[model samples]
Target: MSTEDIDVMVYDYTVAHGAIPAPLNFMGFPKSCCTSVNEEVCHGIPDKSVILKSGDIINVDVSTIYKGYYSDASRMFMIGKVDKKKQDLVAITKECLRIGIEAAKPWAFMGNIGAAIGNYAHKRGYSVVREFGGHGVGVEFHEEPFVCHVGKKNTGMLLVPGMIFTIEPMINMGKKDIYVDAANDWTALTIDGMPSAQWEHTVLITEKGAVSLTY
Candidate 1:
């Protein structure tokens, strides 16, 4: 199916539930959601011409706004019969998100999230994309505290209770370099033409620990 199909489905679901697809028209982003395939990193505009094929991996980023609140999440999908290397990349990237979330504890520095995710991905022969990471989400689409997925622990802003943000790590199979598509000026792709994967989860830092608000 094409990325547009996913967009339409997301639009329909959001409307049916009396919620809005947060990404639609946010900062002039036209789609209801983002679908980044293979080398495409993030902010990939959903298009009818872009079709999915076997051995391809795609990231479907979905965001919702309901009752003046927001939530965001994304997951990687392998079409069929993906190569071993691509499979490993997806697995490693998912683990990056997991570790990133695991490191988000109350009173801990925001850099702890990046430190855990970056080190884990690096050790596994993967590079974390630094151009875009997670962000604060709740009362607004994109808020303060830009979450970076590469930094040292015990540094950056301290994570206090009742704070919420996203933990998305874009991992590349090749080098960490990336560039935005000039034609659309939205879709980001790997500079070396290698595959990339990403996973996102909105986290809420509670008095006990950081909990995933969008899972």
Candidate 2:
């Protein structure tokens, strides 16, 4: 499904379960979903004021609680007819995520996933944002197994079956520097104001491979 569809589904689940209670107040976020469009790196709160346009790329980040378990996922989307440059960026970014998942086999180190993602990003002349990385998710909103998008091979936590986490790679069209908009306090932007894209999935490491729970 499209990122927007996934985003709406997540929000529906959240509202159905009443999971948007205390955290909504605790985090001080204006909305339950984060719909960040082009030039918005992350945490762009969804609002009627910001309507998506054709050729615009957006990231829909969703976090929700279900059956006492929490799940988080995000995906990139092209509002309409995206140009070749943006299309390539989205394609490669998705590939980088796939590559990272491929490295999440049993007995594999978390660093392997990072190496795979970084290597693909580097090869494509893109840069990965290291400021924010993936983390384990289950009962809590965030958990163990910090998954960085850039690292050396055979390092960090080892993957084991039944382990659930996320591997979200935020890629930039230009430099890797990112800045949070002071005015909004929620939106993150690329330092150069260039476009950025991100894709994420809550994955469970199994004996076969990573199973995407939010897919």
Candidate 3:
């Protein structure tokens, strides 16, 4: 299936549940969701020309606005028979996200999230994308507190209780260098053409710890 096919399904399903696809028309984004494949890092517009094939790994990022609230999440999918390296990259990327989430304790520094994720990924010989990272998103589609995936621990904003944000770390199998596609001015890809994977979760910091608002 093409990326546009994925967008249509997500649009219909979100509307069916009485929710609005937040990315539609937001900041001039035309798609209901983002589909990043292979070397594509993020902000990949859904296009009918982009078709899925074997060994392809894609990230489908979906955001929803419901009853004046917003939700964001993204997950990677392995198409057909993927290579061992690609599979490992996908698995390790997911693990990095898990580590980031675990480190996001209530009242902790926002840098803790990035530090944990960066350390784990770097130790595994992977790199984290720097151009884009997670952000505060609940009252609005995007908010303050730019959350980087690589930083020193105990720095940046403090994770206050009742605050909502996203922890999305784009882990690349090769170097971290990336450049934006000037054509659409949205899609970002790895400069070295290496495979990249990302996993995201909208989180809420509670008194006890951080909880994922998106599954």
**lDDT (CA) for every model shown?**
0.94, 0.83, 0.95
Which clashing pairs does model 1 show? none
Q: Candidate 2: which stretches are off by over 4 Å?
A: 1-13, 17-23
lDDT of 2 by residue, 50-114 (tens): 66778999888877775788888888888779999999998898998888888889888999999
Ranking of candidates on lDDT, top first? 3, 1, 2
1-215, model 1: which lDDT tens digit per residue? 99999999999999999999999988889999999999999989999999999999999999999999999999999997999999999999999999998899998999999999999999988999999989999899889899999999999999999998999999999999999999988999999999999999999999888898877
Query: Per-residue CA lDDT of candidate 3, range 171-207, in tens?
Result: 9999999999999999999999999999999988999
Q: In angstroms, how far off is 59's CA in candidate 3? A: 0.1
- The number of clashing residue pairs in each candidate reads 0, 0, 0
Alpha-carbon error at 80 in model 1, in Å?
Answer: 1.2
Clashing pairs in 2: none
Off by over 4 Å in 1: none
Candidate 3 similarity to native, TM-score? 0.98
